[model samples]
Target: RSLAESLDAELLMYLAQRRITPGFLNEIDLFLRGHPELAEYTPDFVRRFNNARPLAAYRFFLKGYTRPARYVPGILPERDDQITLPHELPSVASTVDDELVDFFDGYEYRYDILRRIDDQVRALCNFLRSGGRLTWTQRLLVGLTLFGNPVDAYKHYEYNYQTEWLPHRYLPEHVVLSEVPKEPDYSVPTARVRTLDGADDKTRHTFLNTRRKMARANDAGV
Candidate 1:
């Protein structure tokens, strides 16, 4: 049990460094729950893991960048601005080295490389969804590169931000009303007055002072 705990901690640290999505963590939790024998060893492991929310708090305390909405703002362009496929896409079979070929062959057992494939899978999904046309060869190459089961692919492609994982302060309407000032009235006399480009220094200073006073009054709710 002690050894398993230590190993799990190490794995969590590694996943944190790799910025693995919460969906992956949830899957792990579900797997653990399914096996009572394994769950017995780790005390409240799933609950504690969910509370820590490592995925949402990945790297910085900010939310995870795994959401498709965060990365893919809109339908991505079919091709680059040059109207050509990216150079990184493998062309001839020789373009892929033996080591990469071997990795793809045994990709099912390569959990360590999962983080690296996340972006590639996202790009492939976006490209396919955007009605981009890919040749049979191109599709085959991409499939080999991003080889994963339907579950893994679905988790990667449709990952959403888990609200419970985010910091409470980031929740909507959680902001302190007092700290957030109301919109100020823009009808101040100084704002209405337009100074000439070469206005005198005194005039400029007066204009600035009026603006500052208006801001202060608005902030003070006066």
Candidate 2:
């Protein structure tokens, strides 16, 4: 099938399974608005989604708990990334670099450093809520970040606090945890991860996504 059709299917599948984070709800609605047929195909999925919005205590999770959307790669830049640097260097580049070091450097939970990027996630979430259209790639990545494997991205990487783990961490009783009945699906391949190539997480703490439930490493030991 086409990518758009595949996305529509996966989108609904994720929604029906109650696998996505609250931050994903608005975009899921947008995808429906753009491609209305998916809703018609699974009316109950749409119905449940519409019914659940009012139940949310905070529509936008801006503080205290990190929004799962923050983990999507393009949404935020790495700390040392000069992409966000001023167009005109106000100070010597080397001097600026030396002064603002990564205090979270060598920190075990590097993903904790990600919570610092909450502003970007908030802005993007607000943008969607205001009727902005995101490219299909954005929606897909967000879907994976919010719903794919709510423990880790790849089967190989299982520790040091991955992005999907945050939703369960901050919002333990998240609305997305409720199970839904199975429905028709057009098979979509599981996203693959080849290697731990990036300079990522310092700690080895791990989690298991026990279907609708979140499982974590024991405090006593692995």
> Tens-digit lDDT track for model 2 on 1-222?
122233454444544444444345454344346645545565665565455433231221111122232233443333212123232322111121211122213435334333322233344445555766554444432333333432222111222233444433433222232332334883423223233775444353333243123223222122
Q: Estimate, for each residue in 1-222, the C-alpha lDDT of model 1 and write its tens digit.
A: 121233355546645443343344454344334445423444354245445534322222122222121111122232333123444543222233322333245345434333334455446546866867665433432443343122223223223222222232122221112233334764433243445764534444456776775565455444
Q: What's the residue-level lDDT of 8 in candidate 1? A: 56
TM-score of 2: 0.22
Candidate 2 regions exceeding 4 Å error are 1-26, 55-76, 79-222
**Full-model lDDT for every candidate:** 0.37, 0.34
Clashing pairs in 2: none
Best candidate, lDDT: 1
Q: Model 1, 80: alpha-carbon shift in Å?
A: 12
In model 1, the worst 10-residue window by lDDT is 66-75
Residue 210, model 2: lDDT of 38
RMSD (Cα, Å) of model 1 = 18.1
RMSD of each: 18.1, 17.7
The residue-level lDDT of candidate 2 at 166 comes to 40
Error of 2 at 69 (Å): 1.8
lDDT of 2 at 90: 25
